[model samples]
Target chain A: MSAQIVAFGLLGGLVLYSAWRVATAPLITHAALFLALTLVGVAGFFFMLQAEFLAVVQILVYVGAVMTVIIFAIMLSTPALIRSGERPTLIQQILSPRYGAIPLLVGVAVTLLLLLAYGTVSWDQVPLTFHPSSQFPGGSTAQGTTGLIGEALLTRYIVPFEVVSLLLLAAMVGAIVLAVEGSRGKEDEARD
Target chain B: MTDVPVEAYLVVAVLLFGLGLFTALRRTNAIMILMGIELMLNAVNLNLVAFSRYLPAGLVDGQVFAVFVITLAAAEAAIGLGIVLMLARKRQSVDVSDFTELKG
Candidate 1:
């Protein structure tokens, strides 16, 4: 009945709808755009959860950077493969036992299993507000969530942070190498 | 102060994960599969942030981990898209069904 629940319901509906479209849209470009909408909805959830920093990052990274990369790849890749071969109606796509049955069953089974496993456990006992002092001893809630996260990254989680930087560097280099190699191969073929 | 139960968030995350799994398995396009993976990762991030908000013990750890997960997702997206572009250039197709052979 509260405003939070109402907001959550709206945002959650948007996310689920967009996610469904992302899964089933006939055009790859449409799916990519739906994926952006889904990410934006998730960012709204982050805002509702009081993780303001993460909400910004979700929008910036997922919707901004990742979606851009995906759209770019879609444009660069094959035009022929972007559209589904048979444009079945949404109802038909769902009703057709052959194409949708297995994946649908698997997805439903996984979701049900997860829900059954976690749903029974009581989550109400958990505290609703974060208390930084409990974890950090001298830490105060006055410190912003973003500031605390930064401190933790530099102090407690420094090793993983550094390692992730290295991993990202490697991935960037590898992507560039693959892209360059692919173009060179095309040039070689043209020459021959 | 929010009365929204953690179960609500869990339900959303679970459904999102299922949708992502369905997309990944059902879609033949490699880029679509990668998008599905991104969706799955986003679901996990949502869980982490939800826990951080409601659980005292989680504190900022969940948020930090979410940041790391986002970073990893970005890296994965870059690498995955790069490979897809390369394959598309080579084969003139991005459909996974077209990629029957391991050795090209």
Candidate 2:
């Protein structure tokens, strides 16, 4: 029990710190790296929460594919697009305190308010532990999380599953068109 | 069985959401802002999965929703990065303030 708490604390702390870095890193590439770290930490949380399948998906999707796409976008774009040397570093941005202060204050305040709100709620009254009797019907065992999820995705939730596939297809075509059109304009510019 | 309270998860989610809001609001760079949006989406996913765990034991709704959220996030990132690419090419700049010619 204590080990679990310690692990959660370590994972949660790493996640929050990495996420903070993602928000404040001056270099766009550095922010992308931090974003990957944050995603990994979230996957850790998913593991601790016992959703092993989701945790793996989190790593495969967010850390693997999404971060790769973000980095590629950063690299392909002109360096001038990423250079923000005029802007102060994170410490200076806070201490010299020009632009982002109000938003930071608002963020902290809202977070505190949310914590307080949840703190007041009665979590103990609700069921907190998984029960054998409550296990999903199709799984051979209660612990077959991946199998259970696959069953749910194909059976009870088939419509949304198909819809998500359609959404992915649309997004793919849209991204290709947009990227190709932009490069074509650059080609025309070069020709002229 | 883990002894951690569900609220611990919620707290993490709130903090992430807050930081994401700060990032989105403060950053002038469009990519940074997009990263912030991703962070916010992640926070929501954490909340959903956390709450889903405590739901009637057999219910995998939360995990299922998390998967869907991941899919949507991927789509969003693709389209958003596409727009960012377009913006970068159009203006030779990626600064959000510079791209505000659309402002009336």
Candidate 3:
């Protein structure tokens, strides 16, 4: 009935479509693209949840950085063009058989039951507190979430914030070790 | 839905987890399985972020944890892919089923 419902319905549909694509797309590259769309939808949901900063970070970090890395990895690994006439998987193959429709029907039924059960549950009683909205004083609305987040990171959450940088450093070291192992093996093979 | 319920996030997470699970099971490629592992890790990150948003108190901690998780995911991909590359160089295959030898 309300505009909010319409928006949610649309987002939900988009989420489902992208998720399905993420699962069913045969090519690894298309699956990654679908993952990017799903990430975008998730960022939109974060905005709706009033986490604008998180939404931006999701788009920046996941879409911009991580997905780029994944795409590069895929490109580095796979052949220039996928060989035609290659079979997808047994799951897809099963879809054409006589018993294929049974699993599909069961899945639909389970989804419907879960939806019905969820509708019967009461969720309004959960305790929730929102940060002082940006619309208020302190020029919060004008400056937006980044300033507040930065302030909090420095003042209130300084220790844990720095700890994350260290974690990333460790990850970088680990990645280097793993990547170099491959090169060492290549040199060995050259000798062989 | 008026207010997006916490259950909504959890349900989406469960679905994502399932996709990761299926991918891990069905994909014969070792690199693809690593990608599936990354998906599972992202699903867990989404769950953490969702709880942080809904609960209101554990904001920065959740964000910090998510950052760590993302870093770990990247490291995992690098290491896992490196191993695959080396395996392909040595064993000349990326199929998981081919990895039967215990040692050099």
DockQ, per-model, please? 0.68, 0.69, 0.29
Best candidate according to DockQ: 2
Ranking by DockQ: 2, 1, 3
> What local lDDT does model 2 show for residue A73?
78
Model 3 spans with C-alpha error above 4 angstroms: A88-125, A130-140, A151-159, B55-61
lDDT of 1 at B83: 95
lDDT of 3 by residue, B22-42 (tens): 556556667667766766776
- Interface root-mean-square deviation (Å) of every model: 2.6, 2.0, 4.8
Q: Work out the TM-score per prediction.
A: 0.90, 0.90, 0.75
Query: What ordering of candidates by lDDT runs from best to worst?
Result: 1, 2, 3
lDDT agreement with native, every candidate: 0.87, 0.84, 0.64
Which regions of candidate 1 deviate over 4 angstroms? Answer: A81-86, A95-99, A124-143
A129-172, model 2: which lDDT tens digit per residue? Answer: 65432243323465557877888899999999999999999999
Ten-residue region with minimum lDDT total, candidate 2 chain A: A131-140
lDDT of 3 by residue, A91-192 (tens): 864474432344345445545665666678776765755443343222255554456567777888778768767776776787787678778877987999
Total clashing pairs in model 3: 0
lDDT of 1 at B17: 99
The superposed Cα distance between candidate 3 and the true structure at residue A116, in angstroms, equals 11
